[model samples]
Target: MKWLWMTGLVCALFASVQAQPQPLPAEVQKRIDAIFDGVVDRWIVQMDRWWHDGQHEHLINMTYFAIMLDPHNISLYENAGWLLWSSDRDDEAVALYQRGLRNNPDVYDMYYELGQYYYIRKRDYAKAREYLEQAIKFPCEWFVWNTLGHVYARLGEREKAVETWQELLRRFPMMPVDQMEAVRKNIRDTMTRDTTPTAGENTQQ
Candidate 1:
């Protein structure tokens, strides 16, 4: 069944490539896109089944195929890398992330994922900080800021960590009250532990 599906995908992709020299009619293009989307959706379903059944190798193969079909799908890269990491294919996961960064140079999430891999898996604080810092240069999620702060703290840069958390609060003012308070508590705790500088003290200088 898997071989049949892969054969169909290969044939479809080959046909599409052969037809690429000529401009496809709008209606024909729409139908082609619909068919392609259907194939991808079915593949996703199969991948999910494989994942649940502990068929890690099969899932990883399908993930690689999915990336080949749609390299721009950021979620695919993230999920595939995570799967590899969880399966103890750590080198493959890092390589997959590097490939993702190559395909998506400007995406913040790729950097964030790499940062997380370094921080959590390798305990490489400097590398984590490097990637997390790059992640913040673009529009990113709240956790990026939070994790970067943690990285700074691990690196013994308590002041920078507090500032990072403070900046997170400033940027996401409408966040949930509990989350907001948690961040404030982190700031307070860090301040109490280290009296070197306040959150914005160094920035003022």
Candidate 2:
């Protein structure tokens, strides 16, 4: 039964892509895509149940199945990558994110996820910086800038860190009041530390 269901899904997707010898009307194409999205969403809900039940193997298998059905689902990639990383399958997690990047070259979230993996898991500050830089080149959420600032601070680039948080404030004036205040505090604290002379410097003076 599972194989039949899988085969049906594959056939449907193959037909949608390959059988379209002539261009489909934009509306028709959109509706078809929406139908497939609905199907994928149902499967994802089942995967969530498997996740909560501690069925790790089933969850992993269903994750791959879901990705096969909808390679463009960024959340699926993110969840799967994080799951593998948390399971101590570090290499697999990296490979999954890399595959997501290949499929979603323009996606900022993929780059951000890779940056986070390096930052939190490997403590490879330089590698994290590389990916975070790429993430900022595209449209992204404010956390991208926030994380980049933290990464710069980790690398001992205090000036860059301050500049990054400042840029975030400049670009997102309408950010929530609490978040704005937090960022302001970050900038102030960084600048204060930047200017305050170290004990060695005070002794030299």
Candidate 3:
């Protein structure tokens, strides 16, 4: 992902090198290479700041320009979508994520990040659960499992949520005691709840 811009530049150069019957003149190719290198250098500087500071707007703009330079770069779409989503531009972000999926269906991070957006930002529990499930098929992260359990709990799938949390604790026994206790408490609470009380009612109890 860090080399996304360079990947774009390299692919362009490779395609230029593979050109059919005739290649570009040496001087013309040299000038094009220099121009591309300059653009990539600028992008690298901008992306460095983006990584350190959360300049989502600048990152998104750079990604758009990079995509225009190399449409085949899948990572550009992923990062751009992430930036847009982080900036609260949900519709455009979703469209970009879908576009990235269309281009490379195996990009599981897109699913994971999209699931996070739905879960944490949109509060769309069903969609979050679906995408997180898809993401787990590729790679299972601890936080994903944790969030998946929360999603199940929110959906009133008490047993499933309990099982999910139990599985996590079993798999990662060294997890902090307080965290494990919290999971256990959630399970116990869910098991004991006979009525679907309102938040205020639960709080008052």
Clashing pairs in 2: none
In terms of TM-score, which candidate is strongest? 1
Provide the lDDT at 178 for model 3. Answer: 77
- lDDT tens string, model 3, 1-205? 6556666666677566767478788998898768776776677577758867977776776776666555556667767776687778889999877766665556466677777778767878799899878876765656666677777777778788778877877877877787778777767886886643333322110
TM-score of each candidate? 0.84, 0.80, 0.64
**lDDT value, residue 105 of candidate 3:** 59
Candidate 3 residue-wise lDDT at 133: 80
Give the Å error, residue 175, model 1: 2.1
158: Cα error in model 3, Å: 0.9
lDDT by residue (1-205, candidate 2, tens digit) is 7834864776577566757789888998788778777777888887788779888767776776677668889988898898899999999999999989998999798999999999878878899999999999999988899888878877778899889999998888888888888888777777777453232321100
Query: Of 2 and 3, which scores higher on TM-score?
Result: 2
Writing each residue's lDDT as its tens digit, candidate 1 over 116-135 gives 99988887889999999999
For model 3 the TM-score comes to: 0.64
Q: Which stretches of model 3 miss by more than 4 angstroms?
A: 1-45, 50-55, 65-79, 102-104, 176-178, 194-205
Spell out the clash pairs found in candidate 3: none
CA RMSD (A), model 2: 6.1
C-alpha lDDT score of every prediction, in listed order: 0.81, 0.81, 0.70
